[model samples]
Target: MTAMPMTDAPAPASGSRPLTRVLIANRGEIALRVIRACRDLGLASVAVYTAADARSAYVELADDAYRLEGTGPQETFLSIPALLAIAHRAGADAVHPGYGYLAESGEFAAAVTAAGLTWVGPSESAITALGDKTGARAVAEAVGAPIARGSAGAVDGVEEALRIAEEIGFPVAVKAVHGGGGRGFRTAADARELPTAFEAASREAAAAFGRGECLIEQQIVAPRHIETQCLADAHGTVRVLSTRDCSLQRRNQKVVEEAPAPGLTAEQEQVLAEASASILSHVGYVGAATCEFLLGADGRLSFMEANARIQVEHTVTEEVTGVDLVAWQLRIAAGERLPEAFPAPRGHAFQFRINAEDPAGGFFPSTGTITACREPAGPGVRMDSGVTEGFHVGTDFDPMLAKLVVTGEDREAALARSRRALDEYRLEGVATLLPLHRALVDAPAFAGSGHTVHTRWLEEDFMPGWTASLTPAEQNGAAAPAEDVEVVVEVDGHRLTVCVPAALAAPPAPERRRSRRISRRGTTVAQDISGLTAPMQGTIVAVDVSPGDRVSAGDRLAVIEAMKMEQPLKAPQDAVVKSVAVAAGAGVRSGDMLIEFED
Candidate 1:
């Protein structure tokens, strides 16, 4: 639907401002999405990049680009001052925070408005009301939306959390008050697991969102993850565009999502749409937002939370509904009003996130340069990518390299298309989720007619039996090079099809190789396999073992934080800790010694 002219209706707190140049305070595919939207609206787009992201695809496509002048995220994307200064330098009249980073930061929104620039999102007050989990829950309750039993507010400590969990029953979820994208979300099956889950969740929350306060909620076991894509304008119009199913997850994070959630009855659809519109309307929210819920086996819907920004899976909705959600964010911020109604959902679409992770290695994050890249193309295939061939995938950011969206006339057709698209898609250089996605399309649980998959189905039912291998890039770069292709370089008069021995290959290219002494699989500590070593580059978040501590095989020793996920290092064999080398918060590279085992 087209936008109507601005009227005398009461506008959102962020009043309409003239649109010209828009600065995107984000990176990767989402930034590219916003840039294309700006171009479609005849507006100039400005891009900001960190030192590591200088060669990203979005930076090159932007009308103007500015260097963030920083080494990491804290000094670049998460720095309010840096982003604002770049906005001023670019002469941008508006700032669009594509999802993540400071996208949900109310302070950032207020600061943008204070600087007399348009914030292309919900008003500051609206974000503040909904950004906090407790406030969002209250709003949902006030609006008569369905909700599950949860703590009154953010719990004080583990004791308080346990008390709340007891009151709500076991099998509960510990969620960060300011968490999104499943960063600080954890689950507990019993009282014994609550404390560790709580502490880890809080530490992760502090690292990701700068807040440690969390709330406890009753877990809806084995439920389908459903959310409604809602859009509101300054003129008080809220439209529920479509419903999506994001139940296929790993470690509480979504991997595959489909638009127009399948198997929902007419009543369930009405409930989702009504509740979504009511929650946003109650908060006087403007711009795009999502209301999440859990549909139980009994067909009851329970409110989960609300996200105050565009989501990574929003592309599937756009494909099926024929609505340009990103463009609407720009137009709505420029004082345009939404029409009375939106078109009904048309076709079915599925989105697969291609993350740089090794599924066989327990989804370990893999870092390497993109040696080869090939995307799929057909009537119903779309690839939104941030990297090109030769672009390096590192541990500095999220593991998601791109998204693959496939659409068809129906769910069956969409699944068929997804199979073709996934097979046709080819990417090398780093390990990714391509293999797992290929397996998912044909899995009995996923392709079954009754929709048997749930939130925990991936880890509990699927992954335990599934297995994949390292990509060619993983073996070539992270380990020793594969057998060299023979070529004759006239050496003395002899033409030789020489194959360089693996032992003689250039010490395994420093930048590409993970560790000099560790094995290719990162299981052995050194050439002799005498100690434990880090498997990837990341920060040590926790060290459970100390010097002189005796540990058995498979005992937890430490935890490493990389690509926003925590990986626990376990003792490979029964041994006494001879010494400890790394401490919590220490940065480490692959093959770096962490603890030495006694003889």
Candidate 2:
């Protein structure tokens, strides 16, 4: 492979007009994060939100806020037109697309530039080139970065995919060309599973990304998922930040990330860092980016893909490097050059994604209002959040409610801090990953043992002990007094002695019947709706009814955007639409009137 010729042009000089106003074209913790950075830099901050996120903390903290059309990601955050309009209306000089949504979208980047706004990210060309997995593989190979063995480009269909799978050997991975976050990905152990895996992956890819093209690659069993944070300037200067180990993952999404990977030999660390820098220079990459790689059991590192925007796990890298990546992104986009040399990372750090998910029940997504929230504090702890007590954790966007980050002098210290932080973190009104993370950090396997990404998910020994170690007091409510036991009870002639001390035997609280009330005095009730209420909070993406429209049971009424997933609210009974309460692009809360049915 021929090396791409390096351009000799010096980095662009910093813009004459410093950033005055910045608009965050994203939601959740990341949006709040950018707003805080703007505050530190003395720049005015603007937040754009869908109706679903109007109450988010980020919106309240911003200097100005705009309501975008549509409740879902596609209609709000990912809508290029909506974002540009917000930037223009807010008089924002720069637009920051936080990670996820359109953060890596080349089209959005170009649009921002065309609108004469600073795009606080990598160049559109670089994003487009590296966004496609197959194209990225080619680039990595060309730059002498190790790439996984696979088909040269996207496979045509099941037959082509099968052929590639066979050539790559059994246990291959079928991945979407435009996929991220582990969506549109599947693995097949052998030829028999190829067809099914291919069809499923293709359908998912088409639905998730509107792309059906896929590529086959050899699945690296027992591989550690590691990535290096890289920064570059327009002058072509690239520097490698500290490396992160994101091995604790579920369903291809990282749950915990730690910086300065543990158990790596000095030589291996240097090699990985250099390789990452080389690739960034080759691509003329600018802004903050992460180069993902799979460290195989044989100690060989294979480049996976390059994330063309700031990563969710970047906070961990920040704790170690003492560099604000988001700020650097803003500086780079404004044509400022990086420092002459990169500084070595200083301590160990870890970040845990606090998501509203139930680990006991298959990690199913949970959404509701956060009735109580108590964040961890003390030395070495930092919290980045989008919600507060009373803020609804609706189904309108990603389930991640906050990020808990900690830093320490070494890995053990970081681990201890993480454990303490998780123990102190309290959230109610919705299930969260706190319990799961606490259990994980306390486990013997995770305490000091080095494990890979695959090890956490596939290793048999690591699964059973997660919930087993919980004490009765921890599993239930607060501990009961020792004297509170010793009572005699008889059931079916069998006598049982139960002891309850005075301290523990408090009088039972009175139970009050919940009042069922519907308030419609001020608001007009739609007369023509016979559909089930939306099961979650979301933005209406597609409205299938209008006033006086007829519908049948099971008919699709509207598609709601929640947690980045689209769910259709269907008619529960046949009825005529007396009035449609919601229009496409409107946000709705659970039990919010959508359409009225004629009686």
Report the C-alpha lDDT of model 2 over 1-599, residue by residue, as the tens digit: 11111122234455323566889988889999998877766678899887777788888988999999775567777789988988998888888888874888888888998899888887788887888898799888887888888999889988898888777798898888885776667788899988867766675566567687889999998788888998888777888888988888775667888898877778778778887888777777888989989888898888988898899999988999899998778767766778887678888998999998655433546787888888999999999988899987766568898999999998888889987888788887887777668767755555656543453462244543333224334334454343233345799999975544535544521111111112112111122245446555666767877888888876777766556544456676688888787887787776787877887
Task: Write down the TM-score for model 1.
Answer: 0.89
lDDT of 1 at 280: 96
lDDT of 1 at 318: 97
lDDT digits (tens) for residues 169-235 of candidate 1: 9999999999688888999999999999999999999988899899999998899999999999888
The collision pairs in model 1 are: none
RMSD of each: 6.2, 10.7
Candidate 2 TM-score versus the reference:
0.79
How accurate locally, in lDDT, is each candidate?
A: 0.86, 0.75
Highest-scoring model, TM-score: 1
In terms of lDDT, the poorest run of 10 residues in model 1 is 510-519
